[model samples]
Target: MDQYKLFLQRMGLIGTSTFLVTITGIMLLPILTQNLSIQDYGVWTQFQITITIIPAIAILGLPYTMVRFLSASKSRTEIQEAFYSILFTVIFASIMGAVALYILVVPISHVLFNGNVGVGLILPLTVIMSALQLVFVDYFRASNQMTKYAVFTTLQAYMVVIFALLLVLMGRGVVGAVTGILITQTLISLIMFTFVLKQIGFKIPRFHNLRQYLTFGLPTIPSNASFWVLDASDRYIIGIVLGITSVSYYSAGYTISSLLTILTSPIYTVLLPILSQFYAERKIRETRFLLNYAIKLYLIVAVPAVIGLSILARPLLYILSTPTLANQGYLITPILATGGLFFGLYCIITQIIVMERKTKITGNIWAISAILNIILDVTFGYFLGIIGIAIITLLLYLTAFLITVYYSLNYIRCDFYVKFAKKTIYAAFFMALSLILLNPYGPVNIVLSGLFSFALYIFVLWLLKGIKTDEIKFFTGMIKESLVNVYCALRGL
Candidate 1:
């Protein structure tokens, strides 16, 4: 029971922080679209995709090892050694990555932007800052410092919004936006590094079990890179095949679809450390229960959310971006939203692999999926335009989830509640029906209709007894606890 309460508290903090990030991202869509031309936005989108993959490659997969190893450590000295080892390793890699970025800037720019190499000058700095930021943020998460993690993440999001918007408004275009990211990450990285140093102190990393860390973390580079291929390669394909303007349209729809992750991501953040701890302690029953509950909770929210996004994709695109984006890219949301749902499920299921120390299996799974995703994305894009690439994403995740689930079951058993899922599906169908009957126009109507649809879904679920009383009590407790925490913080202020 205490464990459950702690989980909820952690969830509330991380969830609130993730929610803030989603809001900032949503806000940035219109600001960026209005400020930069579609072509420029496409270039920015391409740059964003590069950053996602490059830093993962640069870090040599050590951050994930932090989550695995650091979470399991007992002694403060052991924790410090593991933390600083990963930190020093990532720092070295960041310097190497910056140098590589500088050396390859012209070629990369030519490939991604058709020889528009002006952004190359700052790409190295962005890459370095991003790599360090990734390590710092992951360290906090591994240490179970949820409040510090939330504060740093939320600060970075707000800073990016404020600075990026100002730069764009001042006519810096894509360069301004990239600069905003660079500056914000640099500042936040310094702050987080200081915090981590204070916590871990300035001892040599001792290089204890360094080979174990490498053996565990190294294989994940391909896995992470492949997952990136699954997630972001489509934009590159779109940019290459259809041109930058289409990339912007596709990116707008992709961003809207990513809203689904806001629901799952925070839970994912909390789940990793908890699962790691539970597994390490041989608490198999507890681990199984948490896994089942997470799956159910994700479906209960994700099913309706996916349906609703599909229903309101166009209106959302229109309100959040230009009419051009709405008209050209609205269809991309339903596909990607559904894909996002599968991806979230995969995250939950794949924890079995992580818990079992079958990290290499993860690498193999994503490597296979990545190859298939690239093949499908490229072939589909050639034949079917932007929608083809979008469909590829959904298909890729569905495939990955099935494969991961099949392999994961070998390590640990997880339940899937068919009757409960059927109930959720029925309720979601009715929610979609309600929204269709209303067929809301404009942002205000759409927002209201969504709320009505959600309330109706819950009411239907209650009527069907799909939602248990204990679950209600759990959520109520979470709300009450969060409120008390907020009040105390205000009093402190």
Candidate 2:
């Protein structure tokens, strides 16, 4: 198959998986919030933040390195050496990371976990399993094994939800939920390892290209850490300055707004490997086309999503969480959703930078942004509460996006789709207007209004000729092809 078709199919697979994973995550929100005390819920949120940051550091950015370096690899031996080297290195780093985390548990417990020692104790185990899981998942991603990638990704998410829900329901509270996650991560990591071993067999990894891998990957550690700072440090600041209860509120709203990021997930997952391969083959035209097309596709959905999410934030949060959480946190959705939009754009634009192998530039941009974010997070969070932190988040994301665009263009110029975006904005504005006029309330009404608003947005965009006929046909064809592939796979099973 052509790369475009394969990209679409892989995208469809990953997109569907991401949507299911997101839905399951959202389903857990009410379960956790209602079952645990507000303080415990805050601790649960903090646990999540800690796990995310730890794995980003512990994995040492090698997953990204694997994707960049191994995406174009055709030699089984070469793949084996690179994969095992990275995996072994990640294991060592994760062990050291866990030990560090264990040593610092007291401070972390006080600062982030609201002084919950039990949760702090369990974190190192979770981080180690999570770090290993990261390497396993990325191996499939780098190999373009999207079916395996999507299945395992979806399975891991569902398993976490299932285990956490069961444990939380069994009256285990925060620690139980954390334990459940660790169990899921361990199981998934082992299962993935088995599959990888069966495919590539084991090798003692000569570390032939280890230095080159680390060279590309290590810079990303700072970038990934900085991203976590941008993406999550506000929770820490909120927990510290405002209190754990306020962290719960901020996290709740942030979670709802983060649904906007699901639109970017498949693109982020699929684009990198494909672009890496294309660029490696020196297919510059295809590379540029993919990048430009990705941004356009992202904005088409993302623009309307930002507007729709912002408009429906209150009702969505109310339905998903408690009234108190909804009322206190709903305002955060618009700001964060807007930030998510910019962040999504930044993700797409940075592919060019990645293609050019200027990861240090990307790292530097985020490093500066993260520092500014931390400073602003403290200042605004201390003075103005979670709302101030949310505003700062939006500004920093916008700054990152602008800087990335400016730098990325020096490598390869991309169409920003200005006119197309203007049309999408118009459609989204009308969608927002329709929702406002309808004034959707309650679960059933919100569901209905959301559907109507989306349809209206499409209709308006269609009338504006923003969606061309060929584009519609192209998507229709992609969907039909995806369904046929699913049907064939099911029959084979």
Return the top candidate by lDDT. 2
Residues 235-336 of candidate 1: C-alpha lDDT, one tens digit per residue: 887887778888988888888888887777778788889989999899999999999988888887889999898889888888889999989888888999
Candidate with the greatest TM-score versus the true structure: 2
Model 2 poorest ten-residue lDDT run: 484-493
lDDT of 2 by residue, 235-261 (tens): 888888888999989988888788886
Model 2 error, position 397 (Å): 0.8
The lDDT for every candidate, in the order shown, is 0.84, 0.87
Each candidate structure's TM-score, on Cα atoms with residue i matched to residue i, is 0.96, 0.97
Candidate 2 lDDT = 0.87
lDDT of 2 at 290: 90
